[model samples]
Target: MLRTLWKHVAADLTLAAPLLRLHFHDCFVRGCDASVLLDSTANNTAEKDSPPDLTLGGFNVIDEIKTELEKACPGVVSCADIVALAARDSVSFQYKRLLWKVLLGRRDGTISRASEVIANLPPPYFNFTQLKQSFSSKGLTVHDLVVLSGAHTIGNSHCPSFDNRLYNFTGKGDQDPSLSPPYAAYLKTQCKSLSDDTTQLEMDPGSSLSFDNHYYKLLLQHEGLFESDAALLTHKTSLNEVKKMLISRNFFAEFGQSMRRMGNVQVLTGTEGEIRKKCSVVN
Candidate 1:
């Protein structure tokens, strides 16, 4: 069912990126319980409405898969596990290689507040120190930070995501000097203004579809699209991780290990939460 849905929902990086992104958002807040899938009610705003998640797609994909699973075996599959599997398959399909083993039996949470997203999710403008602090606070290592950032290898980021790097960088009428000058000029053509939220730029220029270490190669060239991606070069620990990732032959294995660890963050099992009938709403 996931394979059939993958073709219709994600022929390119558009759907694949959001599936991975939604998984990350779910894992970071409330431990991959699918709290990120909850819909906004009249009394509350959900995480999906958060600024970071405002552009996130693939919500319907999750719903579609959940519907299929319910029809096949009622009250057995969890929305959380569906997201985990979808994220894995999306990367696997794009990379043309298997990535991770997503554990099952995760339950869905009933709460998803927008404020938690702002507090938990790191912005693209965060520097190395800030990014490290954010990930470390969540019990993730510097290794996870670099490996997961590799997801950028197959996604398109809105112009506003990295607008500060292009114009008004450091609150001045100039660009981020750290960004490659040629690449910055090229980005200027694609993203005409900081307010141009409609334009989406590929994070990895030549190989946006493959899930390899080319993102690291691009970072080495200062071609990383986000400030956080460039920030990897500034810190000693992350810099070493990047260099190691670049040289490591076991790319998929290492990524799979990290991905599984990330999926295990604050999970709900053994009657902690419920298996919702609908992924977008609590039963």
Candidate 2:
């Protein structure tokens, strides 16, 4: 049932990136328990309603998979597992050879808070130190930070995610000096203004749809879209890791390992949490 649903949904081509992002966000905030999938109620706001997660897509795809799982095995499969599987499947479908075995048995979290999103999920504007602290806090390493960042090779980011780098670097209306000059000019044309929220740019430029090492190449060229991306070059170790990732073979293997490590972040197992019937609501 999961395979069939994935086959049908994978036809979208665009869904893979967001599903991957959804899993990352879910894991980082509440330890891969699917807290990010919950909807806000009258009394509280969910992580999904948070500003960082507002742009998150592909919920309907997870919903479709959950519906089938519930019909087939009742409460057997948890939404958290579904999210992990969906992320792995979507990326594997796109990258073909890049596959990772997702360790399941994770249960859905009952709590989801909008307030926790910003502090947990690393922002686009984070510098090297902040990015390292953010990843290290989750028990990930410098290698994980560089390899996992390769995921940026495939998505589209809104202007607001990186606009400050193009229009206002230091509150003085200057562009980020680290950004490639030509790329900065090109981005300015597309982004228009600092407040432009509607424009979206490909993270890896021409190779946005491919899950490959093109992102590392862009980073080497000083063309990374976010400050967090450019931050990798700020450190000698991370910069060396970025150079290593330029080899597609090494990057693919390391990405899967990093993802597996990330998947285990604060996960709940052995009846610690309930298997949610509907991903968006507590059961």
Candidate 3:
């Protein structure tokens, strides 16, 4: 019942969607214990001395909604649980279809550090081997890696995230020469210049808002925008699994299952972490 209500509250705060997803991704990949959110600061470190973009972009919106939740439910609801609920609910809100069963009662971590973000988050230029290692480090299989990458289906990547792909890819940076001619041509147009905006690159061209097997379909057609995405197609084990899911109704089913599993990943629960008065800064 609490989880259900939190879902609605999260939807009322639209932009909280992605922030919530990221929180769960971090927890699931590591543990719900918030260790992943910790950063390394050798000496005295203040928030100002930390990374400027410390909070996830939409975290302010999430913080507002969380404040409302606190008022209504007081200490009953945990911020980590809210993060998980918001992630699943956000996807449902976007797709208008139920995908995952989210577990609740995850407590918030007291610690959050910028260095952790730099260490855990996968780099854009990461190849298949590096990605596999990263996922493995988190106890996830290659299949989980592929499915989670599908989150790109609903989110937008900034130009900085993919700039190296556009300007530095050996065969073709922005437009890979190996990609289908038409698709390559389209990407060339999309990423014409370094200064060109990348938020416009829709993961699924026709229906950017919907979550489906389109990302997999894109990989099949060689339209994957990032090297990490495109690499899924190169490995037979991972590629075949992704292909099977793309063709079957099981794609949605498995995606939801994977998402639920992701939500349960190493989260800081109980008294391990604090519920930040502000999602961006520790209280």
Candidate 2 displacement at residue 112 in angstroms = 0.3
Model 1 misplaced stretches (Cα beyond 4 Å): 9-13, 95-97
lDDT of each: 0.86, 0.90, 0.62
Question: What is the alpha-carbon lDDT for the whole of candidate 2?
Answer: 0.90
Give the worst 10-residue stretch by lDDT in candidate 3.
Answer: 46-55
Tens-place lDDT digits, model 2, residues 1-283: 4575468546777777898999999989978999999999999999999999999998888888899889989998999998888888887775454388888789889999999999999999999999999999999999999998899988899999999998889999999999999999999999999889998989988887777789998999999999999999999999999999988789888888999999999999997989998999998
Better of 1 and 2 by TM-score: 2
Q: After TM-score superposition, what is the CA distance of residue 7 in candidate 2 from its true location, in Å? A: 2.9
* Candidate 1, 1-283: lDDT as tens digits: 6575558545555677788888998998878999999989999999999889898888888888888889999989999998999888887775555567777778888889998998988899999999889888878999999988888888788899898888999888789999999999999999998779899888888776666778888899998999999999998988888888886575566788888988988888888889999998898
- Strongest candidate by TM-score: 2
Error of 2 at 283 (Å): 0.8
Listed in order, each prediction's TM-score against the native is: 0.96, 0.97, 0.80
Q: Give the true-structure RMSD of model 1.
A: 1.5
Model 2 stretches with alpha carbons more than 4 Å out: 95-98
- What local lDDT does model 1 show for residue 142? 90
Q: Model 1 reaches what TM-score against the true structure?
A: 0.96
